[model samples]
Target: MKAMTYERFGNADVLELKEVPDAHPGSDSVLVQVKAASINPVDYKVRQGHLKGLIDTVFPVIPAWDVSGVVVKPGLDTPEFEVGDEILAYARKDFISNGTLAELVEVPVRTAVHKPKELSFEEAAALPLTGLTALQTVRRAGVSAGQRVLIHAAAGGVGSFATQLAVLAGARVVGTASERNHEYLRSLGAEPVTYGDDLVESARALAPEGFDVILDFAGHSAMQTVPDLLRDGGIVASITDHRARDVYGGQYVWVRPDRANLAELAGLAARGSLKIEIAEVFDLAEAAEAYRKLETGHVRGKIVVRV
Candidate 1:
């Protein structure tokens, strides 16, 4: 099978299209014939060796965790899915090899869920990692009706999902984004605040009483405002900044793959309540170019590679 691979960590230039051994399912896994895969910032960060201490590097690593495809075979011990079932998965493992960027991927049943019939393969591929991150962060913060919520980087991939989910949960959301994306954030049901030196003041102007919950998807000093923005007993959660937990008495979120949460997102999408945005799509052979686009750091939604 052909895959986008990198033997060593570095720049996007290190990625190559090459033939590799085909992947098969293990006892608790399924073999998926990939239809689409999405790129996350973590993909490039992992390629640059940023996660060296957390995840061991395996040579000739295939990069990407989000996949949407059809099951070609299921493992002998796996009974949740079968051949010809359409599915999506956040196919992350302890090691950084055998990822979802290949034509064939081995996905564990624990991380896999049925794809919503309403979503295209590209849209389904875009949901797992970012969707899971947003869903988990919102739940961790315990956002509820009538509360005032603030979301950093609310126009980005995970932030977009978080914004909508919070709105659906009945929180009045204020999202930080650039001026160009303010309207986009508003479309996701958030009141937009331009992120900058005036961010805190701007957020205060919207909710002078202080926010009932704040979620940080952007790490660039976003946590510094917690003291000024959060109401007493209000919760804060961050996916990017660890100081939210260590210093601010908040939670630092690491997204975990859960079959139940994935199913909830699928159900939302199926009901036309959750939206998946595709900023761009690249062919399998052009995955390197796709990574280059992702590294630009300004994409509003997810970027996908079609197999």
Candidate 2:
């Protein structure tokens, strides 16, 4: 199979297109003919060796985690899917040796969920990692109807999803983005605030007493102000851990692949209760270019590599 591979960890320059052996399915896994895969910040972080503590890579590693594809074969012990079943999954980076930046991949049945019939492969591919991250952050913040929820980096991958999910959960969503994304965030049902000196004041104006929940995906030093922007007993969750320990008075959010959650999200997408945004799509051969675009941090939604 043809795949995007890296001989060593570094910049996107290190990735190349090459032929690699097809992976075999394990007893509890399924081999997917990958149709689309999304790029996450973690993909580049792994390439740069920044996630060494969590991901130990060998040379010629394939790095991608979010995938939407069809099952070509299901493992002996797997019954969740069968041949030709379309599915979306947040692949467990540990078992998939090679990531989704390939023509095919083997993912555990537990990590794979049925794809939403309402979405195309590209849209489903974009949902896993970022969707899960945003879902977990919102849950951690305990956002409820009528509460004011503040989301940082409102236009980026996870942030975009967070805004929509928070709004759906009945929170008066407030999101921070550049002026360019303000309208977009509002479309997602959020009150948008531009990231700048008066961000706090702007947010305060929107909710005089401050937010009831703060979820920060843009772990910049600015996240440290989230606590001050929250009402007492309100929660705060950070995807990037802006070291706001002093003011958190809440929980830190770390995303994990939960098949049940993915399944629920799939249902939501199918029911129109959630949305998946695909900013762009690149052919698998253009993985390097995809990484370059992702690093720019200008994407309105997710970027996918079509396998």
- Candidate maximizing TM-score: 1
How far is each candidate from the true structure, as Cα RMSD in Å? Answer: 0.8, 1.4
Q: What TM-score should be assigned to candidate 2?
A: 0.96
Q: How many clashing residue pairs appear in each of the predictions shown?
A: 0, 0
**TM-score to true structure, per model:** 0.98, 0.96
Could you give me the TM-score of model 1 versus the true structure?
Answer: 0.98
Model 2 local distance difference test score? 0.86
Give the runs in model 1 whose Cα sits over 4 Å from its true position.
none
Model 2 segments beyond 4 Å from truth?
242-247
lDDT of 2 by residue, 47-160 (tens): 888877765677778888899999998999997899999999999656324888888899888788999789999989999999999888888777889988888898999998
Top model number, lDDT? 1
Model 2 Cα shift for residue 56 (angstroms): 2.0
lDDT of 1 by residue, 1-307 (tens): 9999999989999999999999999999999999999999999999999998998989999999999999999999989998999999999998999898899999999999999788999999999999999999999999899999999999999999999999999999999999999889888889999988999899999999999999999988888889999989888899988888898788999999998999999889889899888999999899999999989889998999999
